[model samples]
Target chain A: MRPYLYIAKVRMLSALAYRFDVLSSIVIQCLAVIASCFFWIAAYGNQQAALGVTRDQMLTYTVMSSTLACLLTMNVENRIAASVQKGSVALDLLKPVNIFGIYLWEDIGSVAIAFLQNAVPLLLIGALFIVAPVPASAAHFLLFILSAAFSYMINWLIAALFGMWSFRIVRIFPLLCMKGHMIRLLSGSVIPLWFFPQWLQTVLSFLPFRYIYQLPLSVYIGILSPRETAAQMGIQFIWILLLGCLFFEIKKGVTRHLLVQGG
Target chain B: MPLIKVNDLVKEYTVIKKGKGLKGALKSLLHKEKEILRAVNHISFSIQHGEIVGYIGPNGAGKSTTVKMLSGILSPTSGEILIDGLSPQKDRKRVVQNLGVVFGQRSQLNWDLRLGESFELLKRIYRIDDRQYQENLAMMDAILEIHKFIHTPVRQLSLGQRMRGDLAAAMLHSPQVLFLDEPTIGLDVDGKQAIRKFVKEINRLKQTTVILTTHDLGDIQELCSRLIIISEGTIVEDGSLSDLIDRIAPYRILHVELYEEAELPIHPLAEKIRQDGTAAVYRFDKKKVTAAQLIEDLSCFCKMKDFRLEEARIEDIIRAAYHKKEKLEGV
Candidate 1:
């Protein structure tokens, strides 16, 4: 655990050297959300309180979703895939610490960066357009925070599971890119879960993807009442436990095939 | 106690072979031939503490594979490796805590970060205290001249400069054993010589055990007292430098330059193998004759203007060993 923090801090500081890349990414992602926010604001302007969602409420949902996206993303899969490909995985494995733990901390490190670069700015922008919804009360906000923590674990586990393919496949980037794009689309960042048809929304509720992006954001936006939010938090906690086991199993399976080349 | 020990180490790899052409590539998706390559086979060697041994071999000779196993990078298919009395594959973290490694082709330094920043990061990763860290930085900066580019990013440094810094970084925390795989490769003559001098100095000053694998013969000739040449996954020669040369190749090339064309050397001491106008080459065996005797015999037959003796170098002997293996296999 001590070394984990050390690696995470080092990696974060190293990443800070590339401020231009970080700044560019923030600008581009902000533009993307702003473009979608305006389009949906226009769509809600024509509706006369349809679906119990006003223009402000719809914009709030978009803002909340984007913030959650920022907190949840940090290139965890890319790091694993890269280490696997370049054979640098050997160096990490040879370290006197758990490789999975170091990577998870590194994942969290990137999310901390996104929290600064992505979540705060987008939320500020959303506040300018509409009144952003906080949790129902302090309890609801605390629950949402806990749910967000579990979401990090679940998301990392999924990425680790998929990243294991890098050991066997040559062109893993295309597959990883497709996976990331799909997760973004289905988790309600590009398209809000509220806008989806009732049946599609019900089907999506069964999948854990919503807990990471959609459910946590919805809890922030007061879409789920107190009772409903508690139930969703229970589901997220269960997913976290299950995903923890899966991440360990995938780690054991993948490292068995680790071929460390000398020089 | 032995700092490193191995028992019948073997590493086998499964590689898929895709046939040529797009059609074959498509077919490879459905079914492909899997060939097993034995990189290291039943190799067993151990090193006492503070011993610097040179591991040399031709291309595809499994030298690096053995090093990776001892360093805890790769696991053996079937064998046991104990570094400092701990199984490297089983107690990997502990093994690595006491070991350090440097690969010539792959750098451990962060490319975009400054040299001092990289050292700072490693200090934390290796858990070196501030006091020791400061001492190490000062010593390393003086030894490798790291202060020149300590503020410059790694990507901006010359290859030679980066290599010097890398050596210092690997030695930080004063790891008890160091595995250097081709550490002096691709450097100029002066750069190579500099690394050799530093390596010798460290081994003598610190008593740090060093296992070096390299294609460069100079590395073995200069630093190593004992050399091991492994070919086709087996050590063919393991002895002092002079002993290996004596065992493998017992021949020398003697060249003579005369004022006129003359090929008359059929004596017991020397034999003319080849002849060109005004020049002749002789093969002399020490067991059969001496260089002085061969020169004297050749001088009597032909009026010699210039003469020089050539013994089979380390590189030539290793090459001959490999070529001999290839010839026996008819490959």
Candidate 2:
């Protein structure tokens, strides 16, 4: 446990070493959030409500979802792919710590730093210009935070499972690009599920992407009742368990692949 | 019992067989061809408690693969590796706790962090006690002189400094077995001396078992008590350096300059391989005839102006070992 924490701490310090990269990413995410807010404003022009959502709720949804998208982004797959290609993954496996634990803590360190450098500033800037609604209750805000935590775990597990593919296929840029597009279109980061047709919504309910953004952002903006938030949180946990099992299975294959191929 | 033992270890890779031409590429895309490459064939060796064994081989000879398997970075396809009575594949964590590995071409330290910071992270990762950690640092600092640039970022350090840092980092945990793949590679004479001295110091003080894979024969001559030469996924030769030299290159060249042009002295054990004017060179087996006895005999026949003896060089011995099959084929 102490070792993993130290890994995270070292990773955080390393991430902070590139001040210019961090600052530029923060600026880019802020621009993304601001652009989404304007797009929502134009889409909802002269309408008090559309698709069972009030204008203010829609504005909050757009801002929160975009900010969450920026905050919850996990690129563990890129790290895994780069390490495998560089042959440094051997050094990683040499350590006594669990490989997945190292990646998890490293990603946590990066996300934690990004939250401080990007999410806080972006949300503050968004609050000043956007017509965002406050949470329906204190419980809703707390539950939204909880839901976002679950969202991060689900996102990380999915990214880790995807990263395991790198052990088999060294070049994963195309796969990564496809994953990004899928998340953007299906995870409700760029577009809310409320705007999608009922049939698409039914299809999405069976998938895991919506839980990444829509479920958490809806709770944050007071769009979901307390009971529905609880149910959705349950679904998030289920996804975590499912993805966790799949990650371990893929990890076994990765270990065997590395052993045979001498990565 | 030996501290490290490997038994008939094997690792095989299935590589896609890509064709050369554009048409062959298209054909391969439809029905892919695969070939099995055995990187490490049935090779086995054991090392005792404190020994510096130089594992040497040419490129693509499976040196790194063996090191990787020993360090628990890769599992053997079939066979057993026991590090201090524990299997690295079965008990990786426990085995890794006592293992340290360093790759000359790759660093384990974080590029963004200071050298000290990286050491601290390793300290935590290995769970070295405060006192032991300080003692290890002091020991490493004394030998490696890492304190000179301990605060510098890893990327900012020169190659020598970075190599020192890497050596120190690998030792911070005080691992029992150290695996160094090309430790002295790409280093200046001074840097190489520093590494050699450090390796000697740790082995003396801590009795650490070091398995080093290097193409640098200087490292082998200066440090390793035993040599293991692998070629084409098999151990071609394994013995003391002198024994290997004797087996592959048995004779020493004795250059003798006589006072006048005369018939070279003929001895039963010595052969005059080269003669130019008054200069004659005799090749004699050290085991059969000592250089002093041969010289005394030669002086009785001719007045010698000058004479010098040269032993077989390690480079020639190693090169001969690498091409042993070729030499046999020529014979």
Scored by TM-score, the top model is 2
Give DockQ per model, in order.
Answer: 0.54, 0.68
* Model 2 whole-model lDDT (C-alpha atoms): 0.86
Top DockQ model = 2
Q: Note the clash tally of each candidate.
A: 0, 0
The window of 10 residues in a row where model 1 chain B has the poorest summed lDDT is B322-331
Local distance difference test, per candidate? 0.78, 0.86
Candidate 1 lDDT over residue span B17-108, tens digit each: 98899988998999988999998889888888888898888878888888877877777899899888999878877888778788888788
Error of 2 at B72 (Å): 1.3
Clashing pairs in 2: none
Q: What are the per-candidate TM-scores when only chain A is compared? A: 0.90, 0.94
Stretch of 10 with least lDDT, candidate 2 chain B: B322-331
